[model samples]
Target chain A: MEIRTDYADGNYTIHVDYGILEASISEYIAAYSSVHFLVDQNVYALYKDSLLSFVQHPIILEGGEASKSFDAFKHITETLLERGIKRNHLIVVIGGGAAGDAGGFAAATVLRGVDYIQVPTTLLAHDSSIGGKTAINSGHGKNLIGAFHRPKAVIYDLSFLETLPHHELLSGFGEVFKHALLKDEETVRTLMDATRTKISLDMMKPFIISGIETKMHYVTTDEKESGIRKFLNLGHTLGHAIEYKYRMPHGMAVMLGLYFMMYASNEKAARNIFDLDSFRQYFELHGYPLEHLKAIDEVEMMTLMGKDKKNQSSDATGFVLMNDFGQCYFTEIDSNQLKKYISQLKESL
Target chain B: MEIRTDYADGNYTIHVDYGILEASISEYIAAYSSVHFLVDQNVYALYKDSLLSFVQHPIILEGGEASKSFDAFKHITETLLERGIKRNHLIVVIGGGAAGDAGGFAAATVLRGVDYIQVPTTLLAHDSSIGGKTAINSGHGKNLIGAFHRPKAVIYDLSFLETLPHHELLSGFGEVFKHALLKDEETVRTLMDATRTKISLDMMKPFIISGIETKMHYVTTDEKESGIRKFLNLGHTLGHAIEYKYRMPHGMAVMLGLYFMMYASNEKAARNIFDLDSFRQYFELHGYPLEHLKAIDEVEMMTLMGKDKKNQSSDATGFVLMNDFGQCYFTEIDSNQLKKYISQLKESL
Candidate 1:
């Protein structure tokens, strides 16, 4: 299936199929004089022959948290320069979130900007690919230095999902659940009813498409995340802090942050969409680290939240809070109130 | 005088007047919660009290060619992060071309993108500010990494032109001469009639406006520099190669390149508006290194030209050629033809 995102510049399509990489990519190969690949090393080793059939001499990098660093980004850009990559050339990133973020950012900044295609092999990429938010982590934070450049296209091949570990599946589901909770009652109900262990393409397709549509809905209107788009950062405030502090996977940290939000919003009578205990149980069954909420100190967590991009004022922090399903608003939470909520959530845990 | 550039995204204004920075900066300070200045150190030292009245504790950087390196870019970005600069924070860059290019690029990429104001103090900056092309030099070549991010506004206080040295005045004229040639026969006639040594604000204002208008006309329509915008690179092909090889000032190197272009184009019957010897004399009087045309090797220059962003095919390099006044076209020049042109140019010199 093909879904189109319309922007003021032009429209781009997302190609989703059970096995699209092996099927489609000839048009992309024919479009540019040079097609270079920046593949995740693990993905390169596993699917070397398949990728080689499409691209020649792919530059492989360490995937996951390792690839998102500024060092890796510099290496990729320098490699492209050494390879004589020109403006008309295309860079195709074949990997998960980290590879896409770093590679997409390099493509965005190299020669001012260049055309790049995203071939997402992991489920978490369903959220990252559509937004055109590319970045490399700084020593102080993740995605500190970045650009908002849309990819030429996103090719999501469902066949690669079979190779993902169980925890990776759960990590991917964190975003799926986020989109569902932000979407409507029907989506939340559907997500809550799904089995975490027996993951299948048939069961995941709708959720992936739904998540993309939800993201594109925010992105196409506000590509730079100036206004309503901050709603997408519903759980990312603490999620990013936790990810940076503990070196947890992005989606897992986001899952923990979501648990915090659900509890805080419920206590404040700000949102009545979900029963707190039931929702926690659903994520707990999927192996989310819900107990970490109690172990993390309130002061340290608040300090991390202060480092958020949306927190412009040095004294206060802004968060995407919900009072009802599909109704998210950016509200500035006072430091005292935020600390109080954190303490209460910790006590409950 | 105010000139506005309207694009699909938003419109930006250029404020061109004498002594407008102190008078006009208050509105900018009031508009954003944080108005941090990234001023060139020399400029800051000279006008510390004046600048302090507008902004407190501005980030100082070594201006000119020193600040255009990748290392300088990293230092400035890290400084911004260390200071807790956020998405909403405005970065006002005050300096010459290097400061504007490097700081504007940092503002463009930090937190995906941020609002930046350009306060150009040098004559060369009049060209850099309006174009929205920000870049940092790479080891491989100049401007290897950059982005097309337009400034929120360009506050050009013409009073700073008094501090410019005689060579800087000549440097600024290089771009003006190119613009005049591309604009029409009248502009060329106006330019050729002027004395090179006695450049004054009264004489330069019209040319500055003319260059900006020529630039904004192309940039407003094609912000990405993908199509007709390449016309602005009239003398830049060899200009960049010479600049990289000999370490000459950008506009001075461009003046030499323009002399070569005028001579070659006249010989090839590409254009015959101006007498070659008279044009050469005009630039030579301004301290342009016209004689160095014989010193630069044709093969080495050709190799450097191949590294240009516009060169997609390995066999040919594109140059902006003019058959008539105001009719510049990007024509592909093969290596053999380029060598012939260079030999003929040196012999004539």
Candidate 2:
């Protein structure tokens, strides 16, 4: 499936298909005179023969979250400059979210701006690739330094997902679950049915397309994240805090944060769509990191959440909370209210 | 004078007038919910009372080229995060080119970008403020990492120019001279006439407007610096090399680079529009750093120029050479040809 985000400047396409890499790689090379590949090291080790067949030189970086640092960004930039990469050249990032964030930012910056393509290898990248947000992590938080630079295209080869570990698959599903919950009840039902049996790469195609479609709906309308795009941060507030404090993977933290929001809504005396037993059962079956939250103190978690970028005040936290499915709104939750919600979640756990 | 660059998103205005600071500061504060100032330390020390009247807590950074470092960029990002600066908040940068580059880049990346206002305090800032190009320097080169983030508005108060050192006044004229030469013969004549007398803040106003006007004309038409915008880099190829190697100030280096291009064109049997004695006389009278080039070797300079972001090949160099006034084109010169031109320039000196 080819999803085109038609903006006034140009059309940005997200191509999702199995075995599309070889064909799309050549197409990108033909369009750009200078094409530099910033590939993940682990991905390179696995697909080096395939990638080397097309491009002779690829800058291989570590595949994990540590690669998304200022040092890595500066190193990539210097490497590109040494290679004589110009503004008109294309940088194709072939990695997961970390690779896209760092490499995309480097491309966005080197010589003021350059065109970049995202070839995501991890399942977690489904949501990240759709949005134009590119960043390197700051010591204070994740994605603190970045820009809204859209990729030239996103080549999502589904075959890569077959190689993903179960935990990685679970990580990607965290976002899938968020999209399903935020989008509508119908999407939620579709997601539940898809996960009813063991999830495979073949069965995941339709859900990946829907996940991207749900995200693009928000992105195309608000590219800058000034309006409805803020709704897309549904699980990210406390998610980022937990992710930072515990060094938990991004999607898993969001998964826990989603549960927290559900509890918070119920405490605020709002309708709870997440009260269903299947929600809890499915999360447990998939090995979501809910047990990690049991050890973390509520005050420490609250302090981390207060430092979130979306918060208007340092004392309070802003949440993209939903009283009902498909109706998310941002609200400021004071420390007292946050403490009450935390106690309720702890008791239930 | 009011200059408006009509981008598809919104109108970017450059307000150039005497005593426009207080009124414009209030106007910007009225528009943004939270306003923070990223001020140059030198500028802050000189104008603390005036700045405090507008903003209570300002992030004071060291003024000059030192501020345009990756460390400074990182520090500013951490500072903003610590200050609880949200996406909707505005970052008002009040300083020269370095402060603008660092602060603007921080604003461009912090929370994936926030609207920034440029309150320029130097004569050279007239050029930097109008363009949305923001960046920090990498170990490889100056401005090797950055983004093309235009400011919401550029407030250029003439009062700041009065406080500038004599060398800085000469420094700004380098760009003004380049603009006049690139713009038209009429602008060139106006610039020459203005410099014939003892230059003051009042006399420089119209020229600053014209320099910004020339830049905005190119920026509005080709914001990405693909085609016509490359004309703006007429002196920057060798200018950046010299600036990088010797640690010369930006505008003074451009002044030398402009002269080199003129000599190269004349050596290539092109008509010498740069054959004016007053041009050399005016430069000497204002203390432009021309003697620095005498000590630097041609091979070292050529090697530095090869790594320029504009060059496609490592061995070859691209120069924005003007055969005639107001008519410039890009051309590739091999190392041997570059060596010959440098020797010719040495002979003339």
Candidate 3:
């Protein structure tokens, strides 16, 4: 079933398990299918069958975490320029979260922002697809270089998610946990009840709405990620540093950070949230490395967070610590206290 | 006097003449002023004393029409890549038409469409400044490389006009004539009546408004510059070819195109709208050459136009020609007839 999720700000649709991709694309300009933005080759090869069955021009790019760089952006843009992809054509970016972010930013800037559609092929995409956020990496940090240009549309086809590895799928679930912890109640309950090893399209409906609802709410309110919306970064400040330093996937690092922050936060602040023990047990049960935080440099990790784009002022470091399920704040935690939490966690671990 | 012109779709401000050529830039996160994306060496030397400038970071570049190329875009983006221009900062572009178009597109694609402002120095900019059309030239053609990203604001300071030569002053008046011919009465009457060799800021006010009104009318109606808005192109088809071939300035070629099209148009389409004899007399009185039409190659010009991005389909020839003053249409004239008109003019001249 092809269902379009609509909102006041924008609408995104899911091209169910079958022929809906072609139907949705036909509604757009004929030139859209020709946009050849850079994408990961692994993700592309896995999904090219479905995309070529629908997309006219598919430019497969080399993939992996390392591909997220300015060099990559230039290479892809130059490729698109060589192909004569004018501003009139739409640059459909298909792949995982990083692909969406990097390709989306590339499309956003190439010829000064061409039209792009996000055909998310991974579980992580439910967060990346809706927001206009597009960027590549500088040596500085993840998402340090990027832009806010909403895609014309997002086509989420559940069929592509079949290729996601078990780790990547669980990695995507971290965001789902976040949405529940930060906003709605139904999300927390829904994930708590997941019994199946593989998440189906039917199983993803509410979480997708809840995730998009959470993301769009923040985007509309902050639009720029300037103030309140940084609350969405709850576990990210420390998690990003861990992801950077240890070279772990973002979701794995975030789980470690989430486990640490549950105690690092004030007891009153974290009360009535998901049972911290269960949160830890569930990720561990899923075979995620919840204790990776013990191996990294606490001081370096703390210092690297001051490097976060979310840092508004030098003295204050932004933290999206949770108070309870459905409540959070993007308030800053002083470096001194953050160091204390880091040291304290290290000692306990 | 600083008077702002709002185009409903966008807005601009005209800072009337003053001595010392004062030009100021205040960097902001908004789409107009920033130090991130601009190239202004001549402007800097000319107005540095009176300019107010602040940017998170500023970088200088060698300036010229050549500086507005894709190579220039690469250079500036590399600088942006080097300096860490977040998508939040606008790229303040100050200069004449070329800088506005090139830098605006750079800002558009850099980080996926940052904000930009135009500080138009040329008299002809009274027309180009109001619309969001921006580009860099490719070997393919003038404005063949570009995108439609409107400026957040435009500052039309008459001080920039001081650098213009007499020919340039006359050349700029083509747009003033264009605005009048396409729509505005007061502007035409004012231009016809002005005997002062130097136009004062106050005297230029009505013409600025008329240009803004006319272009804005077309842009808002057709932001893409496709159907009705192509009417704004009146003489541009032949004019662009003339500019490309003869290496004439944009406005001069356009005036020549207007003259011929006016003469060749059907009587019902012509009538009292354009008196070709007086048109010849007026430009001749103003030192414009009446003989360039002799050298125009009708076959080549028509062939070049077949590749016009505006021509929708096939071997047809289209013109944004006039039904009368204040009325224009994207009418497809017969290729044979258009060719005959050009040949007849070539023979007569």
Candidate 4:
């Protein structure tokens, strides 16, 4: 089912065809025509041959999470400097979440700020790429240092996703599952029901667009994460700490985090729609877990949450708890209470 | 003559205000409705009542050159969180150049970007108060780690100057003097002429404005200090090293750096424009040049420039030597040029 929707705020466009990439990028540059660029390295490598038919400037870098560090920032910054690219010029990044994040951070900070375009290549990046969350890892933290630098434009082509392994597809679905759980009730029912049907590559365009729409709504409400959008972090507070502690991918960590948050909450709105039993069975079918809260150290996990960027004060950390589908609020809860909630959930599991 | 000039962008009024103690920040903030404030504690103590009447969010910090370090950045960023000020909030900063620089840096980095206003309360801040240059000092060097963050507004109330000491006035004027040599030839002449005339504070307006205007022109052209504005650094490279070695105030160091650079280069542009006879005579009258540049390690000075944010590369360091009034360019000059220049100046002295 292609979920029909529209966004006039003009941030993102999903492309299902390979034919539109070059022409769309050229049009953006012409409209914003301050500078030109060649993405010489990194995720740009993935599309070097294909994009050659389009872009004049090409820069590439190694593709991975490890490459999203300060050293990479330094390398990319140096390349821009050598090319004599100033504020007038644009840097184009086309890749997965890591490439988009790192490139966007570098572009924003270099010479105080320059413009850049995002052509995200991963299903997971469908979430990571659109938002203005550009970051680089810092001492003992993932994305500890970053900037809220919005991209000039985000152009996504679904044609790129056909090369994915099954796990990659599952990982991407994990984030879509997150939006469904936190915001859209029908989305959760749709995903669960669709599992029985053919979840083909082309079938996902609408789902991807839906996830983008949901994320954009959250972003527009609180771009700096100072308001209701803190609810978006509902699963991520414990989820990120888990990602660090267990060496899990971000999507996987969020899945585990949601599992615990769902069990702990007593919201009638959440319970009325989501089938906890079906979700548990689905986790098993997907080779995931609904248990193992005991595997993580409670004290150590809270310690990492202490360093989370959202918890900026002495008294409390901001938390996003789901109240109803498609609605949430940013509330500061007692860390002690959070410990109690999670501990209770572990007991039930 | 009291010159009331608008930047042609805003309706700000510069006045023939009394001593720095008499400067009214309340009127300034009221005129421009700022949202958030990051101010140094010492300055806050002096004007907390006045400030509280205006700003909704206030972040007070300790005062020092070292306070411009990243530790202070972390502190203010935490305060921003507690107050819950997001990207859209205005950040009002009042204090010495150090406070404005550090506060501006903090405001710029938090949530990526925030609006900033400056109320400079020191003689040295005449330069720092206006320019978009904001930075934190590091073990590596001063202003080595910084960003070119423009202030939304600046209030240069002369009242802040009355609290300044005589030595500080002398130190701050070093930058003012550099501006004179680079652009404001009449201001340069006026400052020298003032040495012969009675150097009363009120009598010094034209000279001060001339220098301010000169620096403003350079700032407008090269806000990031990437090109033509480097000429403003003619004496700064050696001046900063002098500050590091002798532990003098910034203006004093720049004055000495100026003397050395001008003496080193008999180049018509550097020499004819930065008139040495007037410089020597003025310093003699002011009882400055408290220490000589004897046995100074030119190599160490060159090393310090490496840590300078302007260098852009390892082998190439940029210097803006005066070519003529209102004209300067950032040219690549190696340590070899630096050594020969310093040696020539040392011998001449």
Would you estimate the TM-scores of all the predictions?
Answer: 0.96, 0.94, 0.78, 0.65
Over B1-349, each residue of candidate 1 has an lDDT whose tens digit, in order, gives 8898978767888999888897677777678878778999888877777643556878888877678776787788888888888877899999988899999999988877889999998888898888789988777778888898889899999888877877887787788888888899888888777655555556888888888899888888777878989888888889989999999888898888877777656756765745887878777776788988889999999988888777777788888877767878777888898899999888888
Report the alpha-carbon TM-score of model 3 versus the true structure. Answer: 0.78
TM-score winner, 2 or 4: 2
> What fraction of native interface contacts does model 1 preserve?
0.77
True contacts kept of each: 0.77, 0.89, 0.10, 0.10
Q: Mind giving the per-residue lDDT tens digits that candidate 3 earns over A185-260?
A: 6667666676234434447656766676777677667766667767778788888888888888777777776776
DockQ (model 4, Cα): 0.13
Question: In terms of DockQ, which candidate is stronger, 1 or 3?
Answer: 1
Clashes of 3: 4
**Leading candidate by TM-score:** 1
lDDT of 2 by residue, B1-349 (tens): 7888867676778898888888887887787778889999999888877633555788988778889887788788889888878877899999998999899999888988888999989988888777788888877788878888888899998888778987788778788889988888888887778777665566788788888888888888888777888889988898999899988788999998888878776666566667735566776667776677666688989878876777766667888888788888888888999988887677666
Which is the better candidate, 2 or 4, if ranked by DockQ?
Answer: 2
Each model's total of backbone clashes: 0, 1, 4, 24
Which residue window of length 10 is worst by lDDT in model 1 chain A? Answer: A193-202
- The positional error of residue B3 in candidate 2, measured at the CA in angstroms, is 3.2
Tens-digit per-residue lDDT, A1-349, candidate 1 = 8889978876788998776785567677678988889999888878777634556788887878688776686688878888888998999998998889989988998888899999988888888888898988776688888898899889998878888877787788778888987898788887666664554455888889988999889999898787988999988888888888888888899999888777767766765555888877777776789888778887888887877777877777788877877888777888899889889888987
